[model samples]
Target: MNRVIKDTGSKYPIIQAPMGWIARSQLASAVCEAGGMGIIETSSGEIDNCKKEIQIMSELTDKPFGVNLPLLFLKDDSMVKFCVEAGVRFVTTSAGDPTKYIKVLKDAGITVYHAVPSLEGSIKAANAGVDGLVVEGTEGGGFKSPVEVGLLVLIQSIKQNLDLPIIAAGGIVDGAGMAAVFAAGAEGIQMGTRFVSSA
Candidate 1:
């Protein structure tokens, strides 16, 4: 539908955020089936288990989905390599500097997206040459920054200085919020808590 993220073959700019402890293959598959990108959050276990989840999710849907590998647990290069080998084309990294793994993933031909809570973090990710930035505000559930920037301000701040496509996360619940973010200059939007409560 002519979204910046859609350029990568996703039908919708909407992404089902990887909810770590709550993420499942079924949930990720459902999002993909619904014409949105789903992401498997692999933060709770070993690389092998994460690899298995990716494989299972891939088997469940031919559509493009992604895996979230928070840098907090990336102890070795094997996890990144495992993602590449598992045929995961897109990755969202959080909790640390994405630069350390940028070249490795890029060389493997995977699109890298970093999650940031501030303009400074966004700038750092841009400088590292990530494909996109998911600008998450404090309202988003889970490990949030204490800085307390809301969606509108955070989105605008990142938009002003970053060249990469910006995806707004936190407090977006439906189509109206989605429309608003696009109008605000974000190429895409990510919603975590909203999806978790849906029937």
Candidate 2:
């Protein structure tokens, strides 16, 4: 099969959403083992704690995985540097503009994926030179856009307007949902609720 996302040598396009406080090492490791990219949420912003989590994840499996960094908590470039030093090859940035850290992560040869809730945000992130875009729709839990666009609509909108690969998120709960996203022109799908149940 032709997987949509190609980062750090992993072939599958799917990414397990890095739900803070819910996405534990075991869960993340499980996804990676299943041929999809797993991500640990280090939203805590403490470099030391993040490092420990990275180490724990590393021990679980040697497969490539990523870390989610909330841009709001990162300061003074510590989190960026920590990811680089920790040898993480992929990172998903959210909660703030991720453009500022693009060059830093790119220089380290890390692939940076930014999250967006609207077409405008997707365009901005693409203009900011993100390697990929995770388009989160209204059905997604946690903080969401006031516009409340659904995944299907957002995917089509992003694909029409942006050249960057799009990772669709929100209300995806099964293999059928995954297939539907790929049919809708999403390069990949990010699943949060489904993974929680899997764990």
Candidate 3:
């Protein structure tokens, strides 16, 4: 079985990828109730809000949910410790080199997944021992590669290069998009814009 689904308990093999200000407790909880893993974003380093959001989510579903911590944006591990203490088992790191913190996360018994925008980033995260990878492309909204590589093209470029479970992101808005990426070798899909727009 794919570790993504095993760890997340997402029935649809999909993740409601954290979208900074947009993916707060309301939208995230809705996705979790819908059978997909919802993620709370901590890009602002707002640990208190994250705590409140996680609390609300816990009230909505028993399924495993996740927290997204963009390592590049935070100054310390205070939030990480909060997640650990809060019993958050799954975390996704993006926008920074996660190597220095991977051990901390893993040692805390958390499953770490890194969101990467290129093959180089993917390999680094894989070597950093992130349990999985959210391989996003330029087509996705928010911070991304200016290289303009399409999602499938980026997936194909790095899929065979790494041993980690790959969760394809960007350019996925519907079932057809999901099926196409799976055929392209992704173990799961993470969609942001589609979910945010719907909310």
Give the best candidate by TM-score. Answer: 3
The prediction achieving the highest lDDT against the true structure is 3
lDDT of 1 at 126: 89
Number of backbone collisions per candidate, in order?
A: 0, 0, 0
| Candidate 1 vs candidate 3, TM-score winner | 3
Q: Write the per-residue lDDT of candidate 1 for residues 1-199, one digit (tens) a residue.
A: 4545653467888888988766668888898888888888877755676677788987798899888888987777777888888778888999899988999888988888899999999999989989998889888887888889988888887888866888889889988988888887788888899879865
How well does candidate 1 score on lDDT at residue 161?
Answer: 85
Candidate 2 per-residue C-alpha lDDT over 1-199 given as tens digits, one digit per residue, 9 for 90 to 100? 3434565346688889988777767888888888888898867555676677778988898889999888876777877788888788899988788788888888998888899998988988888888888889999976676888888999898989877777889998878988888898888889888888773
lDDT of 1 at 181: 81
User: Model 2: what TM-score?
Assistant: 0.92
Clashing pairs in 3: none
| 1 or 2, greater by TM-score | 1
- The segments of candidate 1 whose C-alpha lies over 4 angstroms from its true place after superposition are 1-3
Task: Write the candidate numbers in order of decreasing TM-score.
Answer: 3, 1, 2
Candidate 1 vs candidate 3: the lDDT winner is 3
Candidate number that wins on lDDT, 2 or 3: 3
State the lDDT at 22 in candidate 3. 75
Q: Runs in model 2 with CA error above 4 Å?
A: 1-3
The whole-model lDDT of each prediction reads: 0.84, 0.82, 0.86
Q: Tell me the tens digit of each residue's lDDT in model 3 across 52-154.
A: 8877778877878899988888778888788888888889999899997888889989999898888888888888888988989888988876767788988
